[model samples]
Target: MAEKFLQAERYEAHRPHVRAVAYRMLGSLTEADDALQEAWLRASTTDIAEVRNIGGWLTTIVSRVCLNLLRARQARREDDIDGVPQTQGAATVVDPAAEAEMADEVGVALLVVMETLGPAERLTFVLHDLFAVSFDDIAVMLEKTPAAARQLASRARRRVRGTPPPTGHVRQSRKREVVDAFLAATRAGDFEALVALLHPDVVLTADPAVIPSPEPVVILGAHTVAKGAMAAIERAAATGVALLDGECGLLMAQGRGLRLILRFAVQEESGLITEVEVLAERETLAGVEVTAL
Candidate 1:
């Protein structure tokens, strides 16, 4: 009874920190809270009488819980490709405002790039890079050698940083300028400016997942696409310019997931965006390579 009481007290004392770790790992506040509860339940039954570093032990427990949760989430996403409904965690209602708030606090750019990483890579990077947890300790949780754990984190870091811009018909510098301007105008909700950056007859094509229509959406005319861009300002705030399949484009992310990729076709002479291809289908997105510009 005494041991249980002491463990509970310690767990409560470290709840905030543990919750932070879980949030970073899971990216969803609700899921992080769930992972924390699960961690506490496991900690409650563990023999902690001989534990020396109570905080480290508790963090490890929480990390393992979060890691398992990430893996399960990943598996569910894979199943979704086969049209399987994700019943688990569906009943738990999540507040969109809260999730958005949390995503802002966690750095949207990092979360966006991290979404492309594997579960182990995400866990390793979150534990080691964000929290400064030693690779040796993380290796134990991942069942990998310290070097292997380090490698995973390194790979994640590369994805996050992405590669340099590729040589193309349009000047790389001009491509960067256009993408930067487009993102700035979109986030600022400057419709005219956005339209000015686009060709007069610009075509915007989006996968069905983006517009939820029976078929993929094809919006013609610069003004029409600009209007659509206005409605997505909030998402624009979380978007970043990236090299998509050797072309400069924008990556749109929500929470820790890559929601869409916007690839633009720049008119070499005018530097205006002639085409905007919005890729959101899981299969299509998997084939699109993203690198840093």
Candidate 2:
């Protein structure tokens, strides 16, 4: 009874820190909670005498559980499509006091950007860069060599730091502008305007199956994307529906219910938009807020 009490006490004390770590790793509050619950269940079944450092052991268990979840996610992504490549960038250094000010604005935006990173790279970078966990410790959690963990952290650092040119606050504002313009163009059927906004090397990719493309089409360059957009708009119009606010708003038919709400991402360089990523996944769009037009 005494030993059980002691173990429970230790687990309670360390739960908050473990939760923080899991939340940062998974990027979803719900997932973190679930992971913590599973970790605790595993810990409860283990022999108390065999474990030396209870805190460390609990943390490792939590991390391993999160890692397994991440692996499953990666496998699903691979089977669905050729997996998205991991990012290589430097970590953003935000001042403690300034973090609050940036919470809703920059903080949320940064979290969204972090979604682009692969699970392992994100875990390594968050542990090493954000939470100050040693690479050796992270390597243990990941079951990888320290040298490999460090390499993943370095790549993540570069990707985070390498803003699409311009950098800092100015870059963020410009990105918002590009998104707004793209949304406007798609709604108004302004192909020329949309083409003008895109960089010559612009690349547009929509989620497979969700967007209902005849095949996975990768449109290169502003002109090409503009043509594709026009075709898409025409098809949508034929169905007696128009996209609200270009691509950022919900899709509603003349007499039918709301079909889907599309979320867009615009990556820019040197003030020119280079990449337009449209996510039409119903599951992904669940939490997104779209304005009614």
Top candidate on TM-score is: 1
Estimate the Cα RMSD of every predicted model relative to the unseen true structure: 4.3, 13.6
Residues 1-293, candidate 1: write the lDDT tens digits.
88778888988999988888888887777788888888888888888878898889989999999888878888888878766646555434568776765676666656666777888999898888888999999999999999999999999889877766545545877888998999889877787899999999999888888778898888999999888666544566557776677677788666566778888888988999998887788888768777644
| Model 2 agreement with the true structure over 1-293: per-residue lDDT tens digits | 88878878889999988877776666555566788888989988787787787777887788888888778766766776644444313333434333332222223333443555687888888778877878899888777899999999988776654433233556545555765566567767888888887788878776664467776557798899777655554423212111223232223221111333333345543566766554555455545433221
Instruction: Name the regions of candidate 1 deviating beyond 4 angstroms.
Output: 1-17, 42-57, 74-85, 90-92, 104-118, 158-162, 166-174, 207-220, 232-234, 254-257, 267-271
For model 2, the local distance difference test gives: 0.61
Candidate 2 pairs with clashing backbones: 88-158, 88-159, 89-157, 89-158, 89-159, 89-160, 90-157, 90-158, 90-161, 187-246
Candidate 2 shows a clash count of: 10
Q: How close is candidate 1 to the true structure, as a TM-score?
A: 0.74
Flag regions of model 2 displaced more than 4 Å: 49-53, 81-106, 164-293
